[model samples]
Target: MTAPARYPVTVQFGEVNGEPATWAIETLPEALAAVPLGDHGVFIVGAVDPDAFDESDVSVLELLAANAVAAMDAADRRRRLRTYEDALKNVDDMVCVLDGDGAVTYATGPFVSWIGADDLGDVAGRPLDALVDEADAPRVADAVAALTDAATEAGGAPEPTRTVDLTADRDSDRRSRHGELRLSRLSDHGAGVVGSLSDTTDLRRTRTELSAERDRFRRLFDRIPDPVIEVVLEPEETVIDGANPAFEAQFGVDETTLRGRTIDALDIHDDRLGDP
Candidate 1:
C-alpha cells in the first residue's frame, strides 16, 4: 500500500517515517493530515511502509502516549491545586471560600481546627452560615451579601475589610468570635472570603476590665479632698488635662474653665507658688 509523505520526527515522539524530517511537528492540524491531494485520504509519500506496522502494536503505542498525556495533565492540575491548598493551609488566618449562594466551597485547615472539625468534608458544600447560631446567622448572611455586592460594584477590586461577630458552638457552648473578614471575587464570578478569626473573648474581657479600672480611678480622683493636678510635664505646658469635681468645687471653678488655661494666670493659694 502507498504511504503518506514522510512525516517529521519528534524527540519524545518518534518520526512518522524512517527518514529524518523537520524538527518541529504541528499537533492539531498539520501533523494529523497527510494526503497526496491535501485532503483526508491516505497517500503514499513516505519512504517507509506503515502496512508492516501491527494494528495492536500501533494501538498499544498510541494508547500509552494518550495515557501519558492524560496523566501528565492530571498531575499538573493536582500540583497547581496542591500549591493553592498548601498556601491556604499555611496561613495563620482562617481562610474560607464560598460559592455565590454562601455555600462553603473550600475552607482552610485553620477553620477546620478552629471549629473542631476533623476535615473540611463536613463543612464543604454546606451553607456556611448554617453553622452559626440562629441569632448570628442572619448577620453572617448580611455580611456575605454586603461583601458580594461591594465586590461586584468595585469590579472585583476586593471587598473592604469588615468585622463580623458570629457565634460558634465551641465546647458545647455558643461562643462569640470576632473575625476580620475580607472577600475576593473568584474567576467564576462566585465570591470567596479569607481573613483571620481571633478568639476575642479575652480581648473583650480585658476591655471591660480596663473600663472598670478607669471608672474606679476616676471616682477616686474625683473624691479626693486635695486638688490633684495633672500637668503636661514636657514643654512646661499645663492646660488642665483632667480635673476632679472636688478640685473644681474647692476652687469655685468650673472644670471647663480650668481646661486650656495657663496655670500661672489661675488664682491659687500663694503659699503653694514656687520657683519653677
Candidate 2:
C-alpha cells in the first residue's frame, strides 16, 4: 500500500531543485516554466527554448492561465448543477422553477403530475398564471411580488407562503383542489423563484369541519338548561373562558368578573368539581 503523504502538497514556479521525479512533475534541463491557475492547478510547459524563453513568454502563459481557470470553473458549475437536478428528482413535493420573466422554465416530475400534464414538455415556457385558476390569480400575483421584493432586499430572504386553489387543467378552471405554496427566490438558480407545493385538501376540509362543529357546540352550550362553564385546562391551572347564563345566575357572579381568571383565583369550585 502507498503510504499517506506527510508533507503538504504544493508546487513552486520556475525551474528549481526539488524532488520532481517522486511527485511526478515533469522537469526539463533546457527550460521548464509554469503559471499558477489560482488554486485549481498549475499550467506547465516544458522543452521551452533555452534562449528564446523570456518575460514575454511568461506573459503569454499568464493569459492562458486565466482562460484555463475559467474553463475549470465553468466545468465545476455544470457538475454542481447536475447534482442539484439529480437531488430534486428524489424530492416528493411538487417543485417548480420560474425564470426571470416569471415564466415556468422547469418542473420536476411531481410538479408536472400536479399540473395534470402528460410530460414536462407540455408545461414549459408557460406563465404560472396560465396553469392556475383565474380566481386565484390575485393571490398568486401578491405572493410572487412578495418573493421578488424579499429577494431584492436580501440574498438570504425568508420564504413567503400562500394557499392557492388549483385545478386539474388550465382550461378546466374547476379549482376543486387546494395547495399550500411555499416559495423562495433561487438566486443560485437564477434571479428566479423556486417553489414547492404541498396538497392541503385534507387540512382545509378538517378546518372547515372543525369550524362547523364549534358553531354547533356554541349553539348547544347557549340553549342548554344545566349550568355550564367553558374553561381552558392547563397543567398548572384551569382558566375560565366562558360561562352560560344559567351558570352566571346560579353562582351570582357576572361572567365578565369570572372570565380570564383561574378556578383557584375565583375560589368557587367544590371538591366534586375537580373529579372530572
Candidate 3:
C-alpha cells in the first residue's frame, strides 16, 4: 500500500523490488520521466529539452495504475467464485451455507435434488429447517446458531458441531431419509454457518436390520433346552461371555457371575462340565 518515492504508487501487490527511487530517474537523462510498470517493462519518456510534463501528469499515471489494480482484484474474486460453484455442482454430498439468522444462503446440488428443486433459485432463501423434519430442524438451527455466535466471540475459535442424524422431509410415501449433518463456521460464511450433509439412510437401515438379527439369535439361544453358553477362546483360557437360561438355571449361577469368568475360575464340578 505504500507509495514509491516522489512518484507515488496507487496500487501494486506482486512483489517488492529493492530498486532505489533514484533508479528510475537515473534512466532518463532529460526531464523527470521514467516509470517502471513491473519487472518486465519500463516506461521512459525522455524529452529533447527539460520540463516536458509537470507533476500533474505523474499524478494522472498514479490514478490509472490504482484503477487497474482494483479491476484486477475484482476479476480475481469472480474467477475464484466460478471455480467454487463448479466444485459444488459435482459434489455428491450436500453443502449448505446459512446466513447469520440460520437461513439458507447457498446450497449445493445434493440439497437442491433433495428438495425437488430444478435449480438453486427454488432452494435458496429457505430456512435450514425446510430440508429436515420438524423434530430435527430445530436441532440443526440451534447448532448453526451456536457456531455463528461462537465465531463472534472476542477471542474464541468456533468448533464444528458433532455429526448428528437428521431425518429428511417425508416424501409422498411418508418415508423419511436420514442424513448425517456436521455444522461448522468457515471464513467464507462470514458471520454465518456452513453445514455438510452425507446421506446415511441405507447404512442406518442395514445397521438396524443387523441389530434385529442379533436379538432374534439371542432369543433362540435362550430357549435351548440343553445347557448352552457362548465362550471366547483365549490363549490362556476360555472366558464365558453368555449363558442360556437352562445353563444359568442348572448351574445355580446368575448370568452376571458366569460372564467374564474363565472356566477354571468358576469352581464348577467336573461332572457338570461333561458335555462342555
Candidate 1 vs candidate 3, lDDT winner: 3
User: Once model 3 is optimally superposed onto the true structure by TM-score, how far is the C-alpha of residue 9 displaced, in angstroms?
Assistant: 13
Clashing pairs in 3: none
Q: Please write out the lDDT profile of model 3 over residues 44-147, one tens digit for every residue.
A: 55553577777887777666655655565455545554555567677777887666567777788777776556777886788777656778877776677667
Candidate 1 wrong stretches, greater than 4 Å:
1-83, 116-118, 149-159, 169-179, 182-190, 231-236, 260-265, 269-276
- Residue 80 CA displacement from its true place in model 2, Å: 6.0
Please give the distance, in angstroms, between residue 147's alpha carbon in candidate 2 and its true position after superposition: 3.5
lDDT of 1 by residue, 67-95 (tens): 65556555554455455567776676677
Clash number for each model: 3, 0, 0
TM-scores across all candidates? 0.56, 0.59, 0.63
- lDDT over C-alpha atoms for residue 184 of model 1: 43
- Candidate 3: lDDT of 92? 75
Error of 3 at 58 (Å): 32
Error of 1 at 224 (Å): 1.9
